[model samples]
Target: MMDKNQSKRFIQFAAECQSSALYEHLSLHIAEDPELLELSSYAQKGQPMPNLIFGAVHYLLLNGKEHSLKNFYPSLVNQPETEGVFTYFKDFCLAHREEIIPILERKLVQTNEVRRCAYLYPSFCYIYDKVKKPLALIEIGTSSGLQLLWDQFSYSYGTGITYGNPRGRVHITSEIKGDSTPLLLDTAPPVSVRIGVDLHVNDVSNPEDKQWLQALIWPEHHERRELFARASQCVQETPIQLIEGDGVALLSQLSDQISTDSLICVFHTHVANQIPKEAKKRLTETIQEIGSTRDIVHLYNNMNDGDLHLDYVHNGKTYNHTIGATEGRGRWFEWNIVD
Candidate 1:
């Protein structure tokens, strides 16, 4: 549990990293406003409080809530007001206190950043190259399962060449920092299966779910919002199996369903931070248990550290390596994985 000061610091950091002037200003004001900070405490345990509070407010604004605050959000207005946003923000929360509390308590901070597939694209290529088998993808904490369709999307890492599905509806662009280049296939690898497990799965087809997911995007990030809309469309067109449950608990059961012929690749991005330490331990142990029986790859980060990691068990031997460091939104990545 984070104290109010700690929460303030976290929000400050988020504001700095997100490049959202709206959120940055609001976060600074929220840090000093005891009432708003207290209200934020209603968010579900383990959820990022700043994001939840902001999303709840954004949800209300997007869902036809009449308020002056709407004028300050870039998502809502063409020319958003720069000054006195905190006043409107505070006023909106107080006016809709009851409505906001339920949302904060219920909603999880699940932003299905589709551009993250930039790294997943190359990671899958590496897996296919090594095992010479189609990959069976099992994604933990999949909000809408948009990322489960990584192979269905196209990607470009600032190169002249395009990768993955050339005809993909969702085209993701990212920057590759550093000299090391990841093994990127011209076309996506064959996927034998796609399964996503989450405590709550947001069905992209559902209007309310779709709205909530959209609201999770920050007020100023037009690009993220656009990407989200495109990815949501892609997800609806090509659906994957989504299970509603504790992903860590369901790992063993899910892996059993995948064919042995396909290389099982269990992965999650930007999700481990929300997982409890004990659950993360259980997840690791379960993966190791599964690895003992057959080959399995686990690609994840924010469990023990922020760096992206690729861990696997091949021929009864276990291997672990930090593949790269990624921008939280997949804007850029430092690929350390070498040939």
Candidate 2:
């Protein structure tokens, strides 16, 4: 009855999601099983998004649902259209409500993608050229402080364009979309100071938090999954300090700690869109206040979309440009230079 009474908006969302990006297995299974609508009766607000669905799946997989994951999951079996998918899926959902309910209650869809450092390279290089010094960097909404270390990874975006740490643990490659390829930095400038600010921070060392981080990744994306493993390993060798607080509240204070000699850069990818209008306003004001005192570059983009843009202030002048676009997980990049 819970599945029968549960709202179908999530199912509809699943259908649309499959069309846009390639998360067909999770989306399709959910769409086909309207019985899952019964989950609404247990509603943490009467609905669950794909994130909640996958969260439950991951929790079970990481714990004790090996047979369910192995036999039924599309990512594992390679077939969402296979018969009995919705049947087994429904059984799992219904049977595991005890576990799924609390997960649905938490509503955590937070994902920290490390490969996006591939998208940030060109922007960092541009800022380095302007300031000609190492960067003092701070990140907002840094779930695990992973992407905060983008410069530490190597990238091969287009055929001839290669950059970043070649010896780096994680290697990211993206396709070129248009004629205007982005400027490549043979070597990324050094990042001397790095800090992360978030309402809740994930400790990479913690096993439960790490599994949750992995759960946020779409199932079919093994490359991204592997890359995340590498980056996490990289972090163990060099950890960035994470400041637990609201991003805007911490921005000014962190910016103050940066030395005048090194370039100051505040950046976030796929983090801004989740913020409400009022919070975004505060972030904008905080950046502007910092800009008034000195030059700083803000590298940013929204969730799901690959485009990376630059907003920076130099000598009291503000400028904006679309630096490039890449796969959501930074698989490839079509660097767009705005002249």
Candidate 3:
């Protein structure tokens, strides 16, 4: 087995592989494969990868497919055959490269989804600090309510294993970087408000939606499957205010209704990528206009748009945390400049 340093570098190598040869090869392979063609029937230029494969993969990976991904040998590359499981996953990617491209597209290639994925933990940390009491958070583009349950639980990072360690009943040592994390009303109590918005909100509890979520999972990645299952379960029991509407339009409307003292945090992840340039501009303008009057704070992800430099455009100081599936996944930053 590889040592910690080697494993860390391996992750870095994986990060670099994201947009280079691997990406190009997968794209070309998928374009020619019939399975990919069938899977991508509903995928337009802007739409996320079709629902069928995504849901199926999500279920398989999370519920029962950990062994396949964790213990398989990679088929593409021959070098660095450090362990049995890693090699199996590499083989899975290479052998079924064509069939699995769409699944990867949905998870990593989707720009909007990438943005939302990064925002998950940062937004959680931001709210925890800002709201002293239990929060009533409304998340935009919450594919499943995994992010919303971030504060409701805790996590333990171990060698080659990560599991669901609940917060109240179990004491898990986790460090959150922020001024303050919102204290729950009761150790066992749920947050005050939990809602999700998606153009097509995946009903995580529904068997069909679960299937689509499974398909969304990349082949042979079981850790994520575990995460998704826990998250899906959270959404199923929690009463979420999920609605089908344009996020920008809905947020504009929601802004008007939220009381000043209610701690309104308008958040969106991975959803902005679907928004047109004109729509994005309008949304920003709307937020700026709204911020002029009310005490509102937005904890959204930084877009790759050259025009909007959210990295340093803060009126106040900014705090940045380097985050992603791998190290240096750009900066996961937050700051309350409006205050």
Winning model by TM-score: 1
Best-to-worst order by TM-score is: 1, 2, 3
Listed in order, each prediction's TM-score against the native is: 0.96, 0.87, 0.57
TM accuracy, model 3: 0.57
> What lDDT would each prediction earn against the true structure?
0.88, 0.71, 0.45
| Model 1 vs. true fold: TM | 0.96
Candidate 1: regions farther than 4 A off: 1-3, 6-11
Model 3 C-alpha lDDT per residue in residues 1-339, reported as the tens digit of each score: 223432333344444445333322343344444444444443345543323333333334444454454332122223413334433434444455564555545432221122123234334444445544445566667666556665545433222322233442222222323333322222222256666666667677678566666555454333444556655665666577877767677776776766555545556554566668887788767767666665444555434331112221123333333232212221232222232
Residue-pair clash count for candidate 2: 7
Better of 1 and 3 by lDDT: 1
Candidates in order: C-alpha RMSD to true structure:
1.9, 3.5, 9.9
Off by over 4 Å in 2: 1-12, 15-35, 38-48, 66-69, 74-81, 303-307, 324-326
Candidate 3: regions farther than 4 A off: 1-28, 31-42, 48-134, 156-191, 305-339
Q: Residue 49 of model 2: what lDDT?
A: 63
